[model samples]
Target: MKTKFSFLTLLFIVSSFVIAQDIQELKIDSKVNDVTVFLDGAQVTRKKTVDVPTGITNIVFVNLSPYIDSKSIQVKVKGKVMVQSVSQQRNYMNNQPDLAEAEKLHAEIFELRKQLKLAQTYLTITRKELDFLNDNRIISGRNNELSITNLKETSAFYGERLKALKLKEIKQEDDINQLEKKIQQLENQRNQLSDNRGFPTGEIVIKIESKTNSKSEFELSYLVTNAGWFPSYDIRAKNISEPVEILYKANVHQDTKVDWENVKIRFSSSDPNVSGVMPSLNPYYISYNYRPSNYGRIISEVSGFIYDNKGEPLPGASVSVEGTTIGTVADINGHYSLMLPAGSNRLKISFIGYSSKTVDANQPLINIALNESAQELGEVSFRDVEATSISDALQGRIAGLDISRSRNKKNIADKESIAVPFVQTENQTTVEFEISVPYSLKSDKKTYAVEMVDYSLPANYQYFCIPKVDKDAFLLANITDWSKYNFLEGEANIFFEETYIGKTILDVRNAGDTLQVSLGRDKNVVVQRELLKDKTSRQFIGTKKEVSRAWEINVKNNKSQKISMVILDQVPVSKNEEIEIEIKDLSGAKMNNDTGELKWEFELNPAKEKTFNLNYLVKYPKSRTLYIE
Candidate 1:
C-alpha cells in the first residue's frame, strides 16, 4: 500500500507538470515610438496578451523594434501573474530571406553545377576520342589494302562523327552559360530581397508564474535614442496700424528604426543628457575701486577690413572717407586705417569684381564685405525696400532667448488647433510646448514647420531721427504688452502701409513691457545742415584764442500728410575745465546740458519748410594747438 501511494503521488505530480508545460506565444509589436524625446534617449511602449496555466510558463513576445535599449526594458503583467525574468535580444535570421526560398535557389544552383560537371565530362570524352582517331592514322591500317574509294568512305565516316561530336560540345557550352546566367539572376534577386529586410527585428522573452489557470496582459516599455524636436515661428503684420500676428511652430524628427504609424506623441523641452545631481550655492561678495581721471580727448580713428562675399580678403580693395580726399588701399590682409573728421561718419569700399559698399564709421572697428556684382548692367532698380523676412528673424540677435529642455517627462499642450493640440508649460529653468497630435518626421534633415501659437498685439508707429549720426529718418514701431507673449528673439520683416519697408531683428528677451523696432529709413522728410562760414571767426587775445562757429539746418515735409519729426544734434563736450565753451543761439531747442545734446520736435504741414540755427563759441589757450570739428 505504501509503495502504491508513493507511486500515485509521483504520477499526479508528473501529470500536473505536463499540463503546465504549455508555452504560448504573445507577439507584441512596438505600438508607440513617438513618445516625448529627451536629449539622450526616447520613450517607447508595447502591449500584448499571453494565456497562462496554473503554473510557471514562458511567454515570448516578438517583433519589437531593434532600436530598443535592451537594458532599459521593463515588463509588467496583469491578472495574477508574476514576471520572473524579462530580456531582449535580436534575431537577424528571422528577418532574412525565407528558408524555403533560399533553399530553392541553392538547389537550382547545385543542379546547374551538376549539369555543368556532366557537360565537362562529356566534352573531355569527345576530345579524347578525337585524339585517338588522330593517332590511329585511319587513312590506312597495317594489314589492309588501301584504295582511293575505300579511303574516301572511311574519311567520310570519321568526318561525320566528328561534326556531330563538335555540335554536341557547342550545345553543352551554350546550355552551361544559360544555366549559370539564370542562377546568377536568381541569386541577385535573393540578395536584393535581403537588402530590403530593413532594421533587425528583436524579441522579448518573459518568464512568469501564475498561481491558477489564467490569462494575463503584458505591458512592455523601453527607451531609445535618435529622436527630438525643435521650434520655429512665423510673424505677420498686415499694416502699421494693425496688430502683429505671431504663429509659433515646432519641427520634430526621429529615426528610432520603427514606424510610429499614427501613434500619439508628447514633446518635452528637456535634455536627459544633463546630470541630475543637485546644485550647490555659495556665498557672494562685492567690492568697489577708484581711479584717476584723464582729461585728454580721444581722436576718432577708424580701422576695418575688406572681404569678398566668400570671406576672402580683397587685398587691393580701396577704402576711402566719404566726401573727403583722404583714402587708403587695403594691405595683403585687407586691413586699412584712416583718421576720420569729427563730422564725417561714412566710409566707401570698392573692389574690381565686387559692388561698392558704404558703411558707418561710428564704430572703431568696421568690417565690410562686398558682394560680387552681376555681369549684366543697366537693370532697373527697385524703389521699395523689400522685407528680408516675414516671420521670426530674431534668432541669435538676443541673449536669454534660448528654450531649455528637461531630462524626463513632457508637458502636453491643452489647446488644439485644427485637431493638432498644443501644450505650453513653463518653469524657471525651461519652457516647453508639448504637442499631442502625431507628427510624422523622418531621419532625413528636411525641416517641417508646425503652428504652435497665434498672437495679435497693438502697436504704435513713430518717426525718429538722430541727424548727428545718420541723416536718414527711421520709422519705429513701439509695442507694449510684449511681455504677455512668450516670444523668442528672432528676425522680423517690417511692413508699413501695405508696403514692405525692410527687415529688423525682434529682440524681446531684454525688453520689458515695451519693444521698439526700426523699420527702414523714410525718404519723405528731407534734412540738410550747412556751415555758416561767413559768420565764423577766430581771434587771439594774449596767449588765448577764441573761435566762433555757426550752423544752419533746413527740414522739409514733402508728403501729402502732415507729420511730426524729431531732429537731434550735439555740441562738443569738453573733458577739460580749462576749455571754455558757450552756447550763443539755440533757436528754442531743448538741450541736455550734461550731454550737450540738442533736440527739436514739431509738426509740419504738407509741403512745409522749417529752419533752425545753432551757434557756439570755444576759447582755449593759444600756446597749445587745438583740434576743432
Candidate 2:
C-alpha cells in the first residue's frame, strides 16, 4: 500500500508541473491608436487566440510595457472557458527569454575578457624578455671581448634577438587593443538595453479553468498611462447651396513602449481614469433663522424649478451655486434645492442636450428656461474640393455635424434610464466612432485626419459688406436650428461655388439657435468709400466749436446673378457730456444711435450700383482743442 501511494503522489506532482508549463504568449495586433482620449487617461485592447487543453491552464504574457496600470487589467474569454485569476507583476530579474540576444552579447564580452587577459599576459612576458636583453647588453655590461670579429658576431646575435622580442611585443599589444575595442562595443549595447527597458520587464499572468476541451480566443485589455487621444475635426463646404461636411477625428499619442497595430479601436469620451462613483452626499438641514456671528458669513438655501423654452418641465436638470460644489439635480417635477453660502446669489443650471443657464438666486421661486442644444445634423455625405490637404479641408468645411446608429434607433430612452431587454444603446456620456476604413497610428505623436461624419443641411445665403472696415463683400450662410447639430467650437474651411474662398472659426460657445458662417471675401461686388471734403466744415460760435463731416459709399453688383446685400457703416460717437452730436443725413438707412452704426439692406440687380451718404455733426467747447472726423 505504501508503494502504491508513492507512485500516485509522483504522478500528481508531474501533472501539476505540466499544467504550470502550459503557458501561451500572445502578440498584440489590430490596435486602434486613434483613441478617444478624455480630459485624462487612455485605454488599449488586444485580442489573441491560443488553443488550450481541456483542463486548468496557466497563461503567461511576457515583456509587456511597464507603464501598464495593473488594476486596469481585464481578461475576456470566448468559448467554454472560465477565467480564474489575473495578475500582473514586475520582473526585475529580467527573466524574459527575448533578451537572450543581450545575454549572448554579455557572453561574448566574457569570452573577450578572457582572451584579453591571455593577450595581456603574453605582452608582459615579451616586454620582460626585451628588458632582459637590453639590460644584459654584451657591449656595455661586460669587458670580455678581445677581437673585432668576436665583438661583431656577439653584437649581431643580440641585435637579432632584441628585434624578434620587439616584434612579439607589438603583436601581443595589437591583439589586446582589438579585444578591448570589441568588449567596449558589447558594454554599450548593454547600456542601451537598460535605457530601453527603463527598469525591469513587466509580465501579465493569467489563470483560466476550462469546462471542456475546446479551442478558445482571448482578449486582454488594459489601461496604459502616457497613451491618450484628443478630439479633432474637419468641416468642408463646396458651396453655400450645399450641406457642410464635418469629419470627426482623433489625435492619439502614446509612449507606452507597446505598438498597437491595425486593430479594432474604440474611443471613449468619458475618462476611465477618473473616479467612476459620485461623491458621497451627507444630509444637511436648512436653518434660515441661524446666522453666523458675522452677517457677511451667513449661508442660505435656495430652491427652484427648471423648464424648457416651451414651459415644459425639465427633469434631471443640474442646479448649483455658481463656482460652488453644492448642488442638486431636479426631480421628476423639475424641482431642485441647493444650500449656498451667503452673498452667493449666482446659480447655474445645466442638462444634457440643452444649453446651460445661469441666473441670480435672489428669488426663492426662481423659474428658469434652458434652450435645447444644437439640432441633430444631417446624414454623413462627401463633397469634392480643389485643395487636397487635410488642413485645407478643416479650414474649408462647415463647422458642425453627425449621423450614427444611435440616432437611427427610435424609442431610444434617455441615457440615464435602464436599457430595455435585447436592446443595445450607446452610453450618453461618451461618443463612439467606428471608422469605416482601416487606419494605422504610430507611437510617435502626430495628427492624422480620419473622416468621421458628413452632413447635408439647407443653408440661407446672403451678401454682407461692412464698407466702414472692409471694401469687399462677404457671403454669410444663416443656418437656423443650428443647435440641433452637435457642433463644438472648432475651425471651418469655406468654399464658395466650388472655389476655395478662405477659412473662418465656428464658435458655438456663445451662439444662439441660429448659426451664421462667413464665407470668404467676394471682390466681384465693388465698393467705394470717398470723403466729401466740399460738404465738410468747422465753425466757432460763441466759445463753442462745431465740426461737420460727410461721406458717400457706392456699391456695385458686378456679378451676373441678382443678389441681396447689406452695407454697413458707422458714425462717430462722443463720450464727453458737454459734446453734442447729431446725424445730419442718413439717406433713409437704419441707424443704431447707441452704437453709431448705420446699415442698409437692399436688393441689387445684375450690373447695377447703389449709392448712400452719411453725415454727422459734433459740437464741443471751443476753449479745448479736439480732433473730430
Candidate 3:
C-alpha cells in the first residue's frame, strides 16, 4: 500500500472526433481500479462523467480486442495524462523542473493536507524528502535499484543522474512555491480586484443506500472535483469475480491525526477519543495530481491536437493556448506535443466557453473541432466527444482500413474492409478484389464434380475477406461453404500502404483451387491518384521517402496480376521533419530496382477505374506547397 509515486503534470485537452454512425471499437483505459474506460469495441455506457462544455477536441485511444491476446484480452490505451507529479527544492537540485513541476507538487500536497497548519512545514518537508528519496532512491541501488553489467551503463547514467537531481530538487521546491504564487498574483493584481463570489457548482444527492450508512448495498457513483469540496467518490470494482468490501467511516475534526496510502489499500489515523484512531478516510478521488509539490516553472506552450466529429485524438481538454500558455497536458489519445516556440505557429482551444478554437502551423492535427458553439449552460455531463466517431466511419466509406472486430464484437475497429495486396512474385503488380459469380452459382464439370476439402487456417493473420478466385483453382479449395462468396466492385487504382508489418495470407488456402470470401456489402470503394505525378512545386524530388517494397494482391478470374506496390512518397528531413515511403514501380509494366519491386499485367475490371505507371524520387527542402488529406 505504498502507492505514493507522483510527478503530476496532466493537462489533456484534445477531444473532437466522434463519428460512430455504427461499428465501434476505439479502445481506451485508465485503471488501478479507478475507471476511465473507452474501448471503441462497441456499446459502452458508464462514461462516469465528462464535461468541458466547450472548445477543443481531437480524441483517439483505440485497442478494442486487437484480435484478443495482445497479452490476454489486452486493449490498453489512454496515454496523455501529462505531468503527474514532480516536486523537489532541496534547492531545485540546480533547476530544470518539468512535468508541470510534478503536477504542481501534486496539487500542492493534496491541498495542504486540509491545512494542517498550512501543511506542517509541508508534511515535514515531504517526510524529509520521502526519507532521503526513499533511502537513496528506494533502498540503495537508487533509481529503482539493480546494477552490475560492466557498470550497467555507468550505473544507469549515475542512476538517472540521481533521479534527475532528485527531481530537480522537487521542481525547485515547486518553483519556490510558484514564485509565491506569482507573488500572490501580483498582490492580487495590485490589490482590490475582488471577485470573491467563487462558489457556484453544486449537486449531491447520491445515496446508493448511503453506502452502508446504516443500510446495506455498497455500490456508488458521484463525481466532480477541485472547484468544489466534499471528498469525491470513486469506489470502482466493475464485476471482479467477488471481493467488494468497503467500510469507511469519517469523523476527524476533534483535532487532526490523518494518514492513508494507496495501491490495493491501507489506512491509519486513530483518534476516536484522542487516545488514538481516526485518520483513514481515503473515500477515493484518486486524481492525486501531485502538483509541482516543490519545483515548477519551465515554460513553452502552443499546443495542438483536438478532433472528434470523426477525426479522433481528444483525451482530455481544458486548454488555454492564448497569448501563450496557462495549463493542459493529455494528448497521446488526442495527439499533441506542444512546448511552444520550437517554431511556434498558432493555437487556441478554450473551454467553459463553447466556441473558441484557433489552431495553425500546418495542422498538427485538429481533426474536427467544427462544433459552432451553443449548448454549454452547466452540469449535464457526458459529452466526451459526442460529435461522431468509430474512426469517422472508415474515413470516406472504407477506401481502405483493416483492423476489424466491431459489430459489437467489442472494440478494435477503425478502417475495417481492406484486403487487396499480397502478390508474392512473378514480378509483382496489383489492382485487386474479385468475386463475380452468377451462373446459377456456377459449379459443375458435369460428372457430378464434387470434392472441395482442404483445411488449415487457425489464424495466419490476414482476415478481411473477398478472395473467391478459381480461374480453375490457383489455390482456394474450389468452393465449399466458406460463406458462398461475393465482394468485388472497383479496387481503387493502386495505393496500398496499410502499414505493412510482415503481412501473412498464404496464397488463398492452398492455391490449387481457391474459394474463400468474407466481406460483402458490395464494397470496393476506389479513390487514389497522384502516386508521384510528374513532380513540381519547388521540386527537389525528396530528401527522404522513397523506400517502397511490400506487395500482395490476388484475383484468379477478372485478372490483373504481378504486384509489389509501396509507392508512397514524402520529403523534407528537417524544419518540421517528414519521411515516408515504400516505392518502386520503375515504369508501371515491371522492374524491381533491388526490392522497391513492381511487376504488372493489371486487369481486374469489375466496375472500372484504373491507371498505372509509376516512378519515384523526393527530397525537397526549400520551395513548399504541401496540401494533403
Candidate 4:
C-alpha cells in the first residue's frame, strides 16, 4: 500500500508540472482602435488578434500609457477562449521611440557646444598672449638699453600685436556667445519633447484558456488621466437681421505617450475623474455669527504666459485654480487664459520636468516661472490583481458600455458643406459627440483644435451701453432655446459684419432661458455721458445737508441700419439710515429701487440719436460728509 501511494503522488506531481509548463506566454502589440475623451480624462481602447493554442495562454499587450487607471481596465476575448484573469504592470525594459526632432536637436546642440568650447579656447589663448606681451615689454624697457629708433620700432610692434590680440579676443567672445545662444534654443526644444519621457511603458496581460487551437481577437481598454478636452466657440453675426452662426470646437490634448493614429475619437462631456457618488444633504443648523472679515477682491479671469527659469516659454504647461479642477493647458506660444471660479484665490502651475508653483490669482495677468526639478519622478506602479472575469455571453454587452454605437444614421445631402462629420449621442449623465472620420493625434501635450459642429439660430441683436462705466456700445445677441446646443462655459471669439471683434466669455452656467452673448464693442454705435451743470445744486437745512445732481447720456446709431439699444444708469443706494436718496427724474426709464439701477430700451435709425437724463437728490447729516458724483 505504501508503494502504491508513492507512485500516485509522483504522478500527481508530474501532472501539475506539465500543466504549469503548458501555459504559453505571448507578447503582442495592439492598435488603438478608439478613444473617448472626457473633460478630465480619456478612455483608450486597443484591439489585437492572435492565434490561440489548444491550451492556457497568456497574452501581453505592450506599449500603453503609464497613467492608466488599473481598476478601470476591461478585457474581452472573442472565440472559444475563457478569460481566466487580467492584470496590468509597468514594463521598464521597453524603450519608447525617441522624438526625431528632439534627437536632431540634441546632436545639433552637441556640435554647437564643441564650437563654443573651441571659441572659448581661442579667447583664452588670445588673452594669455596679450599678458605675455605686456610682461616682456616691461622687462625689456627696464632691463635693457636701446636707441631711440629701436625703442620706437619696438613700441610700434608691441602696440600692433596688442591691438591684433584684443580684436581676436573680441571676435572669439562674440562667436562663443552666438554658439551658446544656439545651444540654448536647441536644448529648450529637446527639453519640451522629452518632458514626459524616460518613464516605463504600461502593459496589460490576459491569461485565457482555450479548448481548441483557434484564432481569437482581444479588446483591452483603460482610463488614462493625462488626457482631456475643453470646449471653445465662435459666435458670428453678419447683421442684426440675420441669424447668428455659432461654431463649436474642442481643444483636445494628451500626454499619454501613446500616439493615437487614425483612430475613431469621441468627445464626452462627462468627467470620469470626478466622484460620481451621489452627495447627501446633511441637517441644516443655524448658528450665531462672529466677526466677518471682508472677502478679498474677486478676479473674473486670468491670462498669462508660462516660462522656465531660463525665460523660455514652456508650452503644454498646466495652469489650474488651486483646490479646484478648473484648469487649462498652455498653447503652442505658452499663452493660457482661464476664467476664474468664484472665491478662487490661488493658481497652481506645473509642467512635467519642473517644480510646480503656486501664485496668487488676484491679478488678471499672472505669469509664473518654474525651476527644474532636482530629483527624478517616482516610478508609477500598477496593480496586478486578477480583473473581473467577463462571461462570453456578456462580452458584447459589456463592450458596448464603453462606447454606445449609434444605429440611426442621419442622411446628409451635402456632405461637402459640413465642417465636421459627427453624430451626437445622449447618455444618462452626459452627451457624446462621435466623429465620423478617423483622427491622428500625437502623444505631445499640446492642444489640437477639433471642430465639432455649427448651429445657426435666430438671435435678437441689441446694442447695450452703460455709459457710466464704458463709453463703447457692445452688441448683444440673445439666443433662446440654447440648452439644446450643449454649450459649456468657455471663451468665444466674436465676429460681426464679417470682421473679427474680440473674445468674450460665454458663461452658459449662469444663463437664464435666453443666452446672451456679447459681440464685443461697436465703435459705430457711440455713446457719451456728461454731467448737467445747470441742474446740479447743494443746500443746507438746520441739521441736514442736501445735494442734487443730473446727468445726460446720448446714444447714436452711426451705422446705416436701424438698431435697438439698451441704456443703463444707476443712482446711489443709501446704506445708513441718516442718508436718504430720492429720484427726481428718470426720463421714462424703469427703476429698480433696491439696486438703484435704471434701464431704458429704445430704437434708433441710421444717423439718428437719442438722449436720456437721470436726476437724483441725496440728503445727509451736516456732521458727516458723503461724496457723490
TM-score of each: 0.47, 0.49, 0.19, 0.79
User: What are the lDDT scores of the predictions, listed in order?
Assistant: 0.63, 0.63, 0.27, 0.79
Error of 3 at 239 (Å): 43
lDDT of 4 by residue, 530-629 (tens): 9999999999998999999999998888999999999998999988999999889899999888898899999999999988989999999999988998
lDDT of 2 by residue, 503-533 (tens): 5656555568778777768888899988999
Scanning candidate 3 in windows of ten residues, the lowest lDDT window is: 251-260
- Best prediction by TM-score: 4
For candidate 1, the lDDT comes to 0.63
Native-vs-model 3 lDDT?
A: 0.27
Q: What does candidate 4 score on TM?
A: 0.79
Candidate 3: C-alpha RMSD after superposition: 30.1
Better of 2 and 4 by lDDT: 4
Q: After superposition on all CA atoms, what RMSD does each candidate show versus the true structure? A: 23.1, 21.6, 30.1, 6.8
lDDT, residue 473, model 1: 78
